[model samples]
Target: MKLFAVIGDPIVHSKSPRMHNNALQVLMKNAVYTRYHLKDNAKLKEIVNFFNGVNITIPFKEEAFKIADFKDKSVVDIGCANTLLNKNNKIYAYNTDYLGFLKAIDNFCNIKNALILGAGGTARALAFALKIKNIQVTISNRSSNRLKHLSDYECCLYSNLNLHKKFDLVINTTSAGLHDTDLPCNEIILKNIFSNARYAFDVIYGKNTPFLNLAKKYNLKTKDGLDMLLWQGVFAFELFLDCKKTKEIFKAMEIALKLP
Candidate 1:
């Protein structure tokens, strides 16, 4: 049997094990998937040697990229990675989050400008995904610390958001409501931006977060990160299989993600 898991802080809410194990059963892959609460990102390098692969989340994606011995261009381009594969005692990194985000918003129309709220790894992946589409992106974070690595985009602190400016898409990339009732930003700020936005998206899945619910009140087309998780998991699963691509795998994973 092989071992695989997702690593992150506050990982109790993750549905990834349920999402992956079902698909593994369908594929008859002799592997088990689970979650690990990694309070310290630096511990990742010391741990992954035992697992066949691991999916990274939250504050660790950038660190994942930095620690990998080998990297795919996606990770190289974004300086972030959500998937890691171990082979021949070497670690390889990839950024399926960018691909996942692209597939999630594939149907969204006329998205020329986007406002991303957060400055972490997931936010970094999303900004890169939107950049390739030639779309304008403005990243707003509570602090300017992590925003420096994302200098390629128009960056600002939450206090400096142009209250009157509009965007075709507004995304909540913060972990604000993932485990609590808190919204990603001030209610007034969300209202000002969401009111002028055509779409609202939250990176938190499995719940109707205050951010999404508030966007609903404004009649903005909204989506959570469930689809993003499914797609990224699928891509990571493929990498786990060493690229033994098949449509059956996608179907199996899709069915698994729909479970409650």
Candidate 2:
């Protein structure tokens, strides 16, 4: 059988296997999906060659781009990648995070400005993607180091954030609440931002995080990462199978998400 997996440092919680395996089953493709708790970047570069396709996640997305023999233009521009394909012993990289993110928030047509939390590769991909759509982007990371990478856009240290500022969209690209109850920033700050924000998005799925809870308190439209994860998996499915995400596969994957 053809093999596929998503590799990340903290990958035990990933639902990619459940989602992708269901799609493959519905399509009757001879492939299986799994998750890998990656501990080494050098190891990833070597192992991806043995798989038909690979999905990458946090902390490794940028490193994945660096080692790929080929990459999509978006990956080159953003300096990150979340999908990889092995064809004829060569590795190709692509970014489905931005595509999935945009699709997840497609209903909001008037997003003029956005505030992104975190400064990892996912943040970089999202910041650049938003700029291309003519949306103003502001990125905030607690530290100054990662914030420097997106110098072209407005960058702010978490302590320097203006509570009164209003943004149409606020996104959490960090893993702050993924395994815990920590908010990305000060709770009062998030509450202030959410009050003036029209929509809120947190990249952590499977539970209602403290970040989303605060957004709800302000009556803002909020979403967890489920939609983004699902659609990105769909895009990766297309790449893996070398075919379109038919209506059947899409619905099948959606149904799988509701199962245990």
Best by lDDT: 2
Off by over 4 Å in 1: 243-246
For all predicted structures, in order, the TM-scores are 0.95, 0.96
Over 214-260, each residue of candidate 2 has an lDDT whose tens digit, in order, gives 88888889888888888888888998988795577678889999996
| Span of ten consecutive residues with least summed lDDT in model 1 | 241-250
lDDT of 1 by residue, 95-201 (tens): 98888889899889989999999988888889999999999999999988888888799999888999899898999898887656798778898899988898988
- Candidate 2 global CA lDDT score: 0.88
Q: Top model by TM-score, which number? A: 2
lDDT by candidate, in order shown:
0.87, 0.88
Q: Give the TM-score of candidate 1.
A: 0.95
Candidate 2 weakest ten by summed lDDT: 243-252
